[model samples]
Target: MIEIKNLCHSLGGKLILNDINLTLPEGSIMGLVGINGAGKTTLLRLISGVYSADEGEIFCDGLPIGDEKARERLFFLPDDPYFTGHTTGKALFELYRVFYPDIDRKVFLEYMSEFKLDEKKPIRNFSKGMRRQLYIALALSVKPKYLLLDEAFDGLDPLARLSFKRAINQAAEEYGTTVIISSHSLRELEDFCDSYALIDKMTIASSGDIAERVNRYCKFQLAFFEDFSEQIFFGLPVISLEKTGRFARIVLEGKEDDMKKALEKLSPAIVEQMPMDFEEMFIREVEGRGYKV
Candidate 1:
Protein backbone atom coordinates (compact mmCIF):
# COMPACT_ATOMS: atom_id res chain seq x y z
CA MET A 1 0.00 0.00 0.00
CA ILE A 2 1.06 3.60 -0.65
CA GLU A 3 0.24 6.20 2.00
CA ILE A 4 0.75 9.95 1.50
CA LYS A 5 -0.41 12.05 4.40
CA ASN A 6 -0.48 15.84 4.52
CA LEU A 7 2.22 15.92 1.91
CA CYS A 8 3.47 19.35 0.83
CA HIS A 9 6.30 20.51 -1.38
CA SER A 10 7.71 23.70 -2.88
CA LEU A 11 10.33 24.78 -5.38
CA GLY A 12 12.29 28.03 -5.23
CA GLY A 13 9.43 29.93 -3.55
CA LYS A 14 6.19 28.56 -5.03
CA LEU A 15 4.21 25.65 -3.68
CA ILE A 16 4.37 22.66 -6.01
CA LEU A 17 2.15 20.32 -4.02
CA ASN A 18 -0.30 21.22 -1.30
CA ASP A 19 -1.40 19.22 1.72
CA ILE A 20 -2.16 16.17 -0.37
CA ASN A 21 -3.47 12.96 1.18
CA LEU A 22 -3.80 9.83 -0.90
CA THR A 23 -3.88 6.13 -0.11
CA LEU A 24 -3.60 3.38 -2.68
CA PRO A 25 -4.38 -0.08 -1.45
CA GLU A 26 -2.39 -3.07 -2.48
CA GLY A 27 -3.22 -4.83 -5.77
CA SER A 28 -5.07 -1.80 -7.16
CA ILE A 29 -4.31 0.15 -10.32
CA MET A 30 -4.79 3.92 -10.18
CA GLY A 31 -4.73 6.43 -12.99
CA LEU A 32 -3.68 10.01 -12.23
CA VAL A 33 -5.05 12.79 -14.47
CA GLY A 34 -4.11 16.45 -14.51
CA ILE A 35 -3.50 19.26 -16.92
CA ASN A 36 0.04 20.23 -17.83
CA GLY A 37 1.96 21.85 -14.92
CA ALA A 38 -0.78 20.87 -12.49
CA GLY A 39 1.77 19.20 -10.16
CA LYS A 40 1.50 15.77 -11.78
CA THR A 41 5.21 15.25 -12.46
CA THR A 42 6.25 16.94 -9.23
CA LEU A 43 3.92 14.75 -7.23
CA LEU A 44 5.46 11.68 -8.80
CA ARG A 45 8.95 12.99 -8.00
CA LEU A 46 8.02 13.52 -4.36
CA ILE A 47 6.51 10.07 -4.09
CA SER A 48 9.54 8.46 -5.69
CA GLY A 49 11.80 10.30 -3.23
CA VAL A 50 13.60 12.20 -5.99
CA TYR A 51 12.60 15.29 -3.99
CA SER A 52 11.81 15.40 -0.29
CA ALA A 53 8.47 16.71 0.90
CA ASP A 54 8.51 20.05 2.68
CA GLU A 55 5.81 18.87 5.07
CA GLY A 56 4.33 15.53 6.11
CA GLU A 57 5.61 12.19 4.92
CA ILE A 58 4.96 9.44 2.38
CA PHE A 59 5.08 5.72 3.08
CA CYS A 60 4.99 2.51 1.08
CA ASP A 61 3.68 -0.52 2.99
CA GLY A 62 4.44 1.43 6.17
CA LEU A 63 8.01 1.99 4.98
CA PRO A 64 9.06 5.62 4.78
CA ILE A 65 9.07 6.92 1.22
CA GLY A 66 12.62 7.22 -0.22
CA ASP A 67 14.01 5.17 2.63
CA GLU A 68 16.35 2.39 1.52
CA LYS A 69 13.66 -0.26 2.09
CA ALA A 70 11.03 1.77 0.27
CA ARG A 71 13.38 2.40 -2.61
CA GLU A 72 13.95 -1.31 -2.95
CA ARG A 73 10.22 -1.92 -3.41
CA LEU A 74 9.58 0.98 -5.84
CA PHE A 75 10.31 1.46 -9.53
CA PHE A 76 9.54 4.90 -10.97
CA LEU A 77 9.81 5.48 -14.70
CA PRO A 78 9.71 9.11 -15.73
CA ASP A 79 8.30 10.48 -18.97
CA ASP A 80 11.83 11.29 -20.10
CA PRO A 81 14.18 8.50 -19.00
CA TYR A 82 17.90 9.17 -19.15
CA PHE A 83 20.26 6.60 -20.64
CA THR A 84 23.98 6.94 -21.17
CA GLY A 85 25.15 6.87 -24.80
CA HIS A 86 27.28 3.74 -24.39
CA THR A 87 24.73 1.63 -22.48
CA THR A 88 23.10 -1.25 -24.27
CA GLY A 89 19.76 -2.82 -23.36
CA LYS A 90 21.70 -5.74 -21.87
CA ALA A 91 23.89 -3.31 -20.01
CA LEU A 92 20.79 -1.61 -18.63
CA PHE A 93 19.54 -4.95 -17.36
CA GLU A 94 22.92 -5.60 -15.70
CA LEU A 95 22.77 -2.16 -14.04
CA TYR A 96 19.28 -2.81 -12.68
CA ARG A 97 20.35 -6.27 -11.50
CA VAL A 98 22.92 -4.70 -9.21
CA PHE A 99 20.42 -2.28 -7.64
CA TYR A 100 17.06 -4.12 -7.72
CA PRO A 101 18.46 -7.48 -6.51
CA ASP A 102 15.41 -9.29 -7.94
CA ILE A 103 15.85 -8.41 -11.60
CA ASP A 104 14.86 -11.36 -13.80
CA ARG A 105 17.45 -11.93 -16.44
CA LYS A 106 15.38 -14.48 -18.33
CA VAL A 107 12.35 -12.19 -18.51
CA PHE A 108 14.50 -9.31 -19.69
CA LEU A 109 15.99 -11.44 -22.42
CA GLU A 110 12.54 -12.63 -23.47
CA TYR A 111 11.25 -9.04 -23.64
CA MET A 112 14.19 -7.89 -25.69
CA SER A 113 13.47 -10.68 -28.14
CA GLU A 114 9.70 -10.12 -28.10
CA PHE A 115 10.00 -6.38 -28.72
CA LYS A 116 12.70 -6.91 -31.37
CA LEU A 117 14.95 -4.57 -29.40
CA ASP A 118 18.65 -4.99 -30.10
CA GLU A 119 20.41 -5.54 -26.80
CA LYS A 120 23.85 -5.40 -28.40
CA LYS A 121 23.38 -1.89 -29.79
CA PRO A 122 23.90 1.20 -27.65
CA ILE A 123 20.65 2.53 -26.13
CA ARG A 124 21.43 6.04 -27.48
CA ASN A 125 20.81 4.79 -31.00
CA PHE A 126 17.32 3.50 -30.19
CA SER A 127 14.28 5.48 -31.25
CA LYS A 128 12.02 7.14 -28.67
CA GLY A 129 9.49 4.34 -28.99
CA MET A 130 12.21 1.75 -28.56
CA ARG A 131 13.52 3.48 -25.44
CA ARG A 132 10.06 3.45 -23.90
CA GLN A 133 9.71 -0.23 -24.69
CA LEU A 134 13.07 -0.83 -23.04
CA TYR A 135 12.08 0.90 -19.80
CA ILE A 136 8.75 -0.88 -19.62
CA ALA A 137 10.45 -4.22 -20.16
CA LEU A 138 13.06 -3.40 -17.57
CA ALA A 139 10.55 -2.19 -15.00
CA LEU A 140 8.53 -5.36 -15.31
CA SER A 141 11.65 -7.46 -15.01
CA VAL A 142 12.42 -5.84 -11.66
CA LYS A 143 8.98 -6.89 -10.41
CA PRO A 144 8.70 -4.11 -7.84
CA LYS A 145 5.75 -3.97 -5.48
CA TYR A 146 4.99 -0.32 -6.26
CA LEU A 147 5.36 0.98 -9.82
CA LEU A 148 5.12 4.66 -10.71
CA LEU A 149 4.75 5.41 -14.41
CA ASP A 150 4.55 8.94 -15.89
CA GLU A 151 3.09 9.16 -19.41
CA ALA A 152 3.90 5.52 -20.08
CA PHE A 153 2.13 5.61 -23.43
CA ASP A 154 3.33 8.92 -24.79
CA GLY A 155 5.37 7.70 -27.75
CA LEU A 156 4.03 4.25 -28.53
CA ASP A 157 2.23 3.13 -31.64
CA PRO A 158 -1.10 1.33 -31.41
CA LEU A 159 0.41 -2.15 -31.39
CA ALA A 160 2.91 -1.18 -28.76
CA ARG A 161 0.20 0.29 -26.58
CA LEU A 162 -1.81 -2.90 -26.81
CA SER A 163 1.21 -4.86 -25.72
CA PHE A 164 1.89 -2.47 -22.85
CA LYS A 165 -1.67 -2.68 -21.57
CA ARG A 166 -1.60 -6.45 -21.76
CA ALA A 167 1.58 -6.51 -19.72
CA ILE A 168 0.20 -4.10 -17.12
CA ASN A 169 -3.02 -6.03 -16.72
CA GLN A 170 -1.11 -9.26 -16.33
CA ALA A 171 1.10 -7.77 -13.63
CA ALA A 172 -1.87 -6.47 -11.66
CA GLU A 173 -3.72 -9.76 -11.98
CA GLU A 174 -0.83 -12.08 -11.27
CA TYR A 175 1.41 -10.59 -8.61
CA GLY A 176 -0.84 -8.07 -6.84
CA THR A 177 1.38 -5.10 -7.65
CA THR A 178 0.00 -1.64 -6.91
CA VAL A 179 0.57 0.69 -9.87
CA ILE A 180 0.17 4.45 -10.07
CA ILE A 181 0.17 5.66 -13.66
CA SER A 182 0.02 9.34 -14.65
CA SER A 183 -1.10 10.30 -18.11
CA HIS A 184 -2.94 12.95 -20.11
CA SER A 185 -4.50 10.23 -22.31
CA LEU A 186 -7.80 9.60 -20.57
CA ARG A 187 -8.99 7.44 -23.42
CA GLU A 188 -6.09 5.07 -22.90
CA LEU A 189 -6.19 5.12 -19.10
CA GLU A 190 -9.87 4.27 -19.17
CA ASP A 191 -9.08 0.98 -20.83
CA PHE A 192 -7.26 -0.51 -17.82
CA CYS A 193 -7.58 1.65 -14.71
CA ASP A 194 -10.30 0.66 -12.24
CA SER A 195 -10.16 4.12 -10.60
CA TYR A 196 -8.65 7.56 -11.13
CA ALA A 197 -7.76 10.82 -9.41
CA LEU A 198 -8.16 14.24 -10.98
CA ILE A 199 -5.66 16.85 -9.84
CA ASP A 200 -6.45 20.49 -10.46
CA LYS A 201 -5.39 23.85 -8.97
CA MET A 202 -2.75 22.05 -6.89
CA THR A 203 -5.21 19.64 -5.27
CA ILE A 204 -7.17 16.48 -5.86
CA ALA A 205 -10.36 17.75 -7.49
CA SER A 206 -12.02 14.34 -7.54
CA SER A 207 -11.14 10.70 -7.05
CA GLY A 208 -13.19 7.52 -7.04
CA ASP A 209 -14.27 4.43 -8.90
CA ILE A 210 -14.48 5.24 -12.62
CA ALA A 211 -17.84 3.56 -13.07
CA GLU A 212 -19.39 5.28 -10.07
CA ARG A 213 -18.18 8.71 -11.15
CA VAL A 214 -19.31 8.20 -14.76
CA ASN A 215 -22.66 6.84 -13.64
CA ARG A 216 -23.32 9.98 -11.61
CA TYR A 217 -23.59 11.83 -14.92
CA CYS A 218 -26.55 10.70 -16.99
CA LYS A 219 -26.93 11.58 -20.70
CA PHE A 220 -30.00 11.24 -22.85
CA GLN A 221 -31.04 11.83 -26.47
CA LEU A 222 -34.69 12.74 -26.73
CA ALA A 223 -36.88 12.62 -29.80
CA PHE A 224 -40.52 13.73 -29.80
CA PHE A 225 -43.47 12.32 -31.71
CA GLU A 226 -44.96 15.76 -32.18
CA ASP A 227 -43.90 19.30 -31.43
CA PHE A 228 -43.74 19.17 -27.64
CA SER A 229 -42.68 22.25 -25.72
CA GLU A 230 -39.03 21.54 -24.87
CA GLN A 231 -39.41 23.95 -21.98
CA ILE A 232 -41.83 21.52 -20.35
CA PHE A 233 -38.87 19.46 -19.10
CA PHE A 234 -36.86 22.51 -18.13
CA GLY A 235 -35.63 22.90 -14.55
CA LEU A 236 -35.35 19.15 -14.16
CA PRO A 237 -32.31 17.65 -12.41
CA VAL A 238 -29.90 18.37 -15.21
CA ILE A 239 -26.42 19.65 -15.71
CA SER A 240 -26.77 20.61 -19.37
CA LEU A 241 -29.28 20.75 -22.23
CA GLU A 242 -29.13 21.05 -25.98
CA LYS A 243 -32.01 21.82 -28.30
CA THR A 244 -32.50 21.32 -32.01
CA GLY A 245 -35.65 22.04 -34.07
CA ARG A 246 -37.53 18.93 -32.84
CA PHE A 247 -35.24 16.95 -30.54
CA ALA A 248 -33.58 17.84 -27.27
CA ARG A 249 -30.34 16.31 -26.02
CA ILE A 250 -29.86 16.51 -22.28
CA VAL A 251 -27.61 15.33 -19.46
CA LEU A 252 -29.02 14.67 -16.08
CA GLU A 253 -27.90 13.59 -12.58
CA GLY A 254 -29.88 10.68 -11.08
CA LYS A 255 -30.93 7.12 -11.62
CA GLU A 256 -31.83 6.07 -15.17
CA ASP A 257 -34.83 4.09 -13.94
CA ASP A 258 -36.34 7.05 -12.09
CA MET A 259 -35.60 9.25 -15.09
CA LYS A 260 -37.14 6.81 -17.60
CA LYS A 261 -40.35 6.65 -15.56
CA ALA A 262 -40.40 10.41 -15.12
CA LEU A 263 -40.16 10.94 -18.88
CA GLU A 264 -42.82 8.33 -19.64
CA LYS A 265 -45.51 10.94 -19.20
CA LEU A 266 -44.01 12.94 -22.07
CA SER A 267 -44.61 10.05 -24.54
CA PRO A 268 -41.61 11.02 -26.65
CA ALA A 269 -40.61 9.36 -29.92
CA ILE A 270 -37.32 8.09 -28.60
CA VAL A 271 -35.59 8.41 -25.24
CA GLU A 272 -32.41 6.42 -25.30
CA GLN A 273 -29.16 6.33 -23.45
CA MET A 274 -26.34 8.33 -24.97
CA PRO A 275 -23.11 6.44 -25.24
CA MET A 276 -20.26 7.87 -23.16
CA ASP A 277 -16.69 6.69 -23.44
CA PHE A 278 -13.73 7.59 -21.24
CA GLU A 279 -12.75 10.53 -23.39
CA GLU A 280 -16.29 11.90 -23.25
CA MET A 281 -16.34 11.56 -19.47
CA PHE A 282 -13.06 13.42 -19.01
CA ILE A 283 -14.07 16.16 -21.45
CA ARG A 284 -17.32 16.75 -19.62
CA GLU A 285 -15.60 16.67 -16.23
CA VAL A 286 -12.96 19.28 -17.14
CA GLU A 287 -15.49 21.36 -19.03
CA GLY A 288 -17.70 21.33 -15.95
CA ARG A 289 -14.72 22.70 -14.01
CA GLY A 290 -14.33 25.52 -16.58
CA TYR A 291 -11.23 23.96 -18.10
CA LYS A 292 -10.58 22.14 -21.36
CA VAL A 293 -10.08 18.41 -20.83
Candidate 2:
Protein backbone atom coordinates (compact mmCIF):
# COMPACT_ATOMS: atom_id res chain seq x y z
CA MET A 1 0.00 0.00 0.00
CA ILE A 2 1.03 3.59 -0.63
CA GLU A 3 0.19 6.28 1.91
CA ILE A 4 0.68 9.99 1.41
CA LYS A 5 0.25 12.21 4.45
CA ASN A 6 -0.17 15.97 4.33
CA LEU A 7 2.15 16.13 1.33
CA CYS A 8 3.22 19.54 0.13
CA HIS A 9 5.51 20.65 -2.73
CA SER A 10 6.60 23.77 -4.55
CA LEU A 11 8.78 24.69 -7.54
CA GLY A 12 10.58 28.02 -7.81
CA GLY A 13 8.65 29.42 -4.85
CA LYS A 14 5.27 28.55 -6.37
CA LEU A 15 3.26 25.88 -4.61
CA ILE A 16 2.25 22.94 -6.82
CA LEU A 17 0.75 20.48 -4.36
CA ASN A 18 -0.49 21.56 -0.93
CA ASP A 19 -1.25 19.38 2.05
CA ILE A 20 -2.43 16.53 -0.12
CA ASN A 21 -3.21 13.11 1.30
CA LEU A 22 -4.02 9.86 -0.52
CA THR A 23 -4.02 6.11 0.07
CA LEU A 24 -3.69 3.67 -2.80
CA PRO A 25 -4.17 0.02 -1.95
CA GLU A 26 -2.27 -2.97 -3.25
CA GLY A 27 -3.38 -4.51 -6.57
CA SER A 28 -5.54 -1.53 -7.50
CA ILE A 29 -5.29 0.64 -10.61
CA MET A 30 -5.80 4.35 -9.86
CA GLY A 31 -6.41 7.05 -12.44
CA LEU A 32 -5.05 10.53 -11.66
CA VAL A 33 -6.80 13.28 -13.62
CA GLY A 34 -6.89 17.05 -14.01
CA ILE A 35 -6.66 19.83 -16.57
CA ASN A 36 -3.32 20.77 -18.08
CA GLY A 37 -0.97 22.37 -15.50
CA ALA A 38 -3.14 21.03 -12.65
CA GLY A 39 0.03 19.43 -11.19
CA LYS A 40 -0.84 15.88 -12.13
CA THR A 41 2.77 15.26 -13.17
CA THR A 42 4.07 16.96 -10.05
CA LEU A 43 1.97 14.75 -7.81
CA LEU A 44 3.18 11.59 -9.56
CA ARG A 45 6.80 12.78 -9.35
CA LEU A 46 6.45 13.32 -5.61
CA ILE A 47 4.96 9.88 -5.13
CA SER A 48 7.75 8.27 -7.17
CA GLY A 49 10.49 10.24 -5.32
CA VAL A 50 11.62 12.03 -8.51
CA TYR A 51 10.91 15.23 -6.63
CA SER A 52 10.84 15.11 -2.85
CA ALA A 53 7.98 16.82 -1.10
CA ASP A 54 8.63 20.00 0.81
CA GLU A 55 6.59 18.72 3.79
CA GLY A 56 4.83 15.64 5.09
CA GLU A 57 5.70 12.07 4.20
CA ILE A 58 5.04 9.25 1.73
CA PHE A 59 5.40 5.57 2.48
CA CYS A 60 5.23 2.30 0.60
CA ASP A 61 4.34 -0.80 2.59
CA GLY A 62 5.56 0.95 5.82
CA LEU A 63 8.89 2.07 4.31
CA PRO A 64 9.53 5.77 3.77
CA ILE A 65 9.84 7.19 0.23
CA GLY A 66 13.36 7.12 -1.30
CA ASP A 67 14.40 4.25 0.97
CA GLU A 68 16.32 1.76 -1.16
CA LYS A 69 13.96 -1.03 -0.13
CA ALA A 70 10.88 1.03 -0.99
CA ARG A 71 12.43 2.30 -4.18
CA GLU A 72 13.12 -1.22 -5.37
CA ARG A 73 9.42 -2.09 -5.17
CA LEU A 74 8.25 0.69 -7.48
CA PHE A 75 8.89 2.05 -11.00
CA PHE A 76 8.10 5.49 -12.39
CA LEU A 77 7.70 5.97 -16.17
CA PRO A 78 7.64 9.60 -17.15
CA ASP A 79 5.75 10.94 -20.16
CA ASP A 80 9.02 11.29 -22.01
CA PRO A 81 11.52 8.72 -20.84
CA TYR A 82 15.19 9.63 -21.31
CA PHE A 83 17.50 7.47 -23.43
CA THR A 84 20.78 8.25 -25.14
CA GLY A 85 20.95 8.32 -28.96
CA HIS A 86 23.06 5.14 -29.06
CA THR A 87 21.14 3.24 -26.37
CA THR A 88 19.73 -0.02 -27.70
CA GLY A 89 16.71 -1.73 -26.14
CA LYS A 90 18.94 -4.51 -24.74
CA ALA A 91 21.35 -2.01 -23.19
CA LEU A 92 18.45 -0.19 -21.53
CA PHE A 93 17.21 -3.47 -20.06
CA GLU A 94 20.70 -4.32 -18.74
CA LEU A 95 21.07 -0.90 -17.11
CA TYR A 96 17.66 -1.22 -15.47
CA ARG A 97 18.59 -4.70 -14.21
CA VAL A 98 21.52 -3.19 -12.31
CA PHE A 99 18.95 -1.32 -10.17
CA TYR A 100 16.07 -3.82 -10.39
CA PRO A 101 17.99 -7.03 -9.80
CA ASP A 102 14.79 -9.11 -9.98
CA ILE A 103 14.02 -8.10 -13.58
CA ASP A 104 12.91 -11.06 -15.71
CA ARG A 105 14.87 -11.00 -18.93
CA LYS A 106 12.71 -13.77 -20.40
CA VAL A 107 9.54 -11.74 -19.89
CA PHE A 108 11.26 -8.69 -21.35
CA LEU A 109 12.25 -10.61 -24.47
CA GLU A 110 8.72 -11.95 -24.83
CA TYR A 111 7.27 -8.45 -24.67
CA MET A 112 9.83 -7.14 -27.12
CA SER A 113 8.86 -9.94 -29.50
CA GLU A 114 5.14 -9.35 -28.88
CA PHE A 115 5.60 -5.70 -29.83
CA LYS A 116 7.75 -6.74 -32.82
CA LEU A 117 10.52 -4.39 -31.64
CA ASP A 118 14.13 -4.76 -32.76
CA GLU A 119 16.26 -4.76 -29.63
CA LYS A 120 19.43 -4.25 -31.65
CA LYS A 121 18.21 -0.87 -32.92
CA PRO A 122 18.88 2.17 -30.79
CA ILE A 123 15.79 3.53 -28.95
CA ARG A 124 16.49 6.96 -30.45
CA ASN A 125 15.75 5.50 -33.88
CA PHE A 126 12.40 4.02 -32.80
CA SER A 127 9.12 5.73 -33.60
CA LYS A 128 7.13 7.40 -30.81
CA GLY A 129 4.86 4.42 -30.32
CA MET A 130 7.78 2.04 -30.57
CA ARG A 131 9.59 3.92 -27.81
CA ARG A 132 6.49 3.68 -25.63
CA GLN A 133 6.36 -0.05 -26.24
CA LEU A 134 10.01 -0.39 -25.21
CA TYR A 135 9.41 1.38 -21.92
CA ILE A 136 6.28 -0.63 -21.25
CA ALA A 137 8.24 -3.82 -21.82
CA LEU A 138 10.89 -2.55 -19.41
CA ALA A 139 8.22 -1.77 -16.84
CA LEU A 140 6.66 -5.23 -17.09
CA SER A 141 10.07 -6.90 -16.81
CA VAL A 142 10.76 -5.16 -13.49
CA LYS A 143 7.32 -6.23 -12.24
CA PRO A 144 7.38 -3.67 -9.46
CA LYS A 145 4.82 -3.68 -6.67
CA TYR A 146 3.85 -0.12 -7.58
CA LEU A 147 3.94 1.26 -11.17
CA LEU A 148 3.50 4.97 -11.78
CA LEU A 149 2.81 5.87 -15.44
CA ASP A 150 2.50 9.39 -16.80
CA GLU A 151 0.68 9.84 -20.16
CA ALA A 152 0.98 6.13 -20.70
CA PHE A 153 -0.92 5.90 -23.97
CA ASP A 154 0.14 9.04 -25.74
CA GLY A 155 1.24 7.82 -29.17
CA LEU A 156 0.09 4.21 -29.38
CA ASP A 157 -2.28 3.12 -32.10
CA PRO A 158 -5.57 1.38 -31.30
CA LEU A 159 -4.14 -2.12 -31.46
CA ALA A 160 -1.11 -1.13 -29.37
CA ARG A 161 -3.43 0.40 -26.81
CA LEU A 162 -5.29 -2.87 -26.44
CA SER A 163 -2.02 -4.78 -26.07
CA PHE A 164 -0.77 -2.41 -23.39
CA LYS A 165 -4.06 -2.60 -21.52
CA ARG A 166 -3.98 -6.36 -21.61
CA ALA A 167 -0.38 -6.44 -20.38
CA ILE A 168 -1.12 -4.00 -17.57
CA ASN A 169 -4.20 -5.88 -16.41
CA GLN A 170 -2.35 -9.19 -16.55
CA ALA A 171 0.45 -7.80 -14.41
CA ALA A 172 -2.01 -6.39 -11.89
CA GLU A 173 -3.84 -9.72 -11.64
CA GLU A 174 -0.83 -11.99 -11.53
CA TYR A 175 1.68 -9.91 -9.53
CA GLY A 176 -0.67 -7.59 -7.65
CA THR A 177 0.98 -4.61 -9.32
CA THR A 178 -0.50 -1.42 -7.95
CA VAL A 179 -0.66 1.15 -10.77
CA ILE A 180 -1.27 4.90 -10.55
CA ILE A 181 -1.56 6.31 -14.09
CA SER A 182 -1.85 9.96 -15.13
CA SER A 183 -3.31 10.44 -18.59
CA HIS A 184 -5.42 12.77 -20.70
CA SER A 185 -7.18 9.70 -22.11
CA LEU A 186 -10.11 9.49 -19.73
CA ARG A 187 -12.00 6.98 -21.85
CA GLU A 188 -9.05 4.61 -21.78
CA LEU A 189 -8.70 5.12 -18.04
CA GLU A 190 -12.42 4.50 -17.60
CA ASP A 191 -12.05 1.08 -19.23
CA PHE A 192 -9.46 -0.27 -16.75
CA CYS A 193 -9.11 1.89 -13.65
CA ASP A 194 -11.32 0.88 -10.73
CA SER A 195 -10.71 4.07 -8.75
CA TYR A 196 -9.80 7.68 -9.47
CA ALA A 197 -8.09 10.66 -7.81
CA LEU A 198 -8.90 14.05 -9.29
CA ILE A 199 -6.43 16.90 -8.83
CA ASP A 200 -7.70 20.45 -8.55
CA LYS A 201 -6.82 23.70 -6.75
CA MET A 202 -3.38 22.39 -5.73
CA THR A 203 -4.78 19.34 -3.93
CA ILE A 204 -6.76 16.17 -4.34
CA ALA A 205 -10.21 17.69 -4.84
CA SER A 206 -12.06 14.40 -5.31
CA SER A 207 -11.33 10.71 -5.13
CA GLY A 208 -13.45 7.53 -4.98
CA ASP A 209 -14.53 4.32 -6.61
CA ILE A 210 -15.49 5.12 -10.19
CA ALA A 211 -18.59 2.96 -10.46
CA GLU A 212 -20.10 4.14 -7.15
CA ARG A 213 -19.64 7.80 -8.07
CA VAL A 214 -21.17 7.33 -11.54
CA ASN A 215 -24.18 5.48 -10.16
CA ARG A 216 -24.77 8.03 -7.38
CA TYR A 217 -26.37 10.38 -9.88
CA CYS A 218 -28.17 9.85 -13.19
CA LYS A 219 -29.37 11.81 -16.19
CA PHE A 220 -32.93 11.51 -17.46
CA GLN A 221 -34.31 12.63 -20.80
CA LEU A 222 -37.92 13.73 -20.53
CA ALA A 223 -40.54 14.85 -23.04
CA PHE A 224 -43.74 16.36 -21.66
CA PHE A 225 -47.09 15.94 -23.36
CA GLU A 226 -48.23 19.44 -22.54
CA ASP A 227 -46.16 22.59 -22.60
CA PHE A 228 -43.61 22.71 -19.76
CA SER A 229 -41.09 25.23 -18.67
CA GLU A 230 -37.99 25.20 -16.49
CA GLN A 231 -40.25 25.94 -13.49
CA ILE A 232 -41.71 22.45 -13.72
CA PHE A 233 -38.51 20.99 -12.20
CA PHE A 234 -38.02 23.89 -9.83
CA GLY A 235 -38.45 21.95 -6.59
CA LEU A 236 -36.66 18.81 -7.78
CA PRO A 237 -32.98 18.26 -6.96
CA VAL A 238 -31.56 18.87 -10.38
CA ILE A 239 -27.85 19.34 -10.85
CA SER A 240 -28.24 20.61 -14.37
CA LEU A 241 -31.09 21.10 -16.85
CA GLU A 242 -31.25 21.76 -20.56
CA LYS A 243 -34.22 22.34 -22.84
CA THR A 244 -34.85 21.83 -26.57
CA GLY A 245 -38.38 22.75 -27.61
CA ARG A 246 -40.67 20.50 -25.46
CA PHE A 247 -37.87 18.01 -24.72
CA ALA A 248 -35.60 18.34 -21.68
CA ARG A 249 -32.49 16.60 -20.36
CA ILE A 250 -31.82 16.82 -16.67
CA VAL A 251 -29.15 15.41 -14.42
CA LEU A 252 -30.72 14.59 -11.07
CA GLU A 253 -29.03 13.53 -7.87
CA GLY A 254 -30.60 10.20 -6.85
CA LYS A 255 -30.76 6.49 -7.49
CA GLU A 256 -32.42 5.06 -10.60
CA ASP A 257 -35.63 3.88 -8.89
CA ASP A 258 -35.88 7.00 -6.73
CA MET A 259 -35.29 9.26 -9.71
CA LYS A 260 -37.89 7.32 -11.73
CA LYS A 261 -40.46 7.73 -8.96
CA ALA A 262 -39.70 11.43 -8.70
CA LEU A 263 -40.02 11.88 -12.44
CA GLU A 264 -43.25 9.84 -12.50
CA LYS A 265 -44.81 12.35 -10.12
CA LEU A 266 -44.79 14.73 -13.06
CA SER A 267 -46.62 13.17 -16.00
CA PRO A 268 -44.35 13.04 -19.02
CA ALA A 269 -45.04 11.64 -22.46
CA ILE A 270 -41.64 9.97 -22.52
CA VAL A 271 -38.91 9.59 -19.98
CA GLU A 272 -35.72 7.56 -20.21
CA GLN A 273 -32.79 7.36 -17.84
CA MET A 274 -29.48 8.00 -19.58
CA PRO A 275 -26.21 6.32 -18.74
CA MET A 276 -23.15 8.27 -17.64
CA ASP A 277 -19.71 6.80 -18.13
CA PHE A 278 -16.67 7.69 -16.02
CA GLU A 279 -15.63 10.59 -18.21
CA GLU A 280 -18.99 12.36 -17.87
CA MET A 281 -19.01 11.70 -14.15
CA PHE A 282 -15.50 13.15 -13.83
CA ILE A 283 -16.43 16.24 -15.81
CA ARG A 284 -19.40 16.90 -13.57
CA GLU A 285 -17.31 16.34 -10.45
CA VAL A 286 -14.49 18.67 -11.47
CA GLU A 287 -16.95 21.23 -12.80
CA GLY A 288 -18.64 21.20 -9.40
CA ARG A 289 -15.23 22.06 -7.97
CA GLY A 290 -15.17 25.20 -10.17
CA TYR A 291 -12.98 23.73 -12.92
CA LYS A 292 -14.03 25.31 -16.21
CA VAL A 293 -13.80 22.03 -18.12
What RMSD does each model have against the real structure? Answer: 2.1, 1.3
- Give the best candidate by lDDT: 2
Candidate 2 wrongly placed segments (more than 4 Å): none
- Model-by-model lDDT, in order? 0.84, 0.92
* lDDT (Cα, tens digit) per residue for candidate 2, span 1-293: 99999999999999999989999999999999988898999998988999989999999999999898998998999999999989999999989999998999999999999999999999988999999999999999999999999999999999999999999999999999999999989999999999999998899988989888788889999999877879988788787778998899888877889888888888998989898788877777776776666
Q: Which stretch of 10 consecutive residues in model 1 shows the poorest summed lDDT?
A: 275-284
How far is 273's C-alpha from truth in model 2 (Å)?
1.2
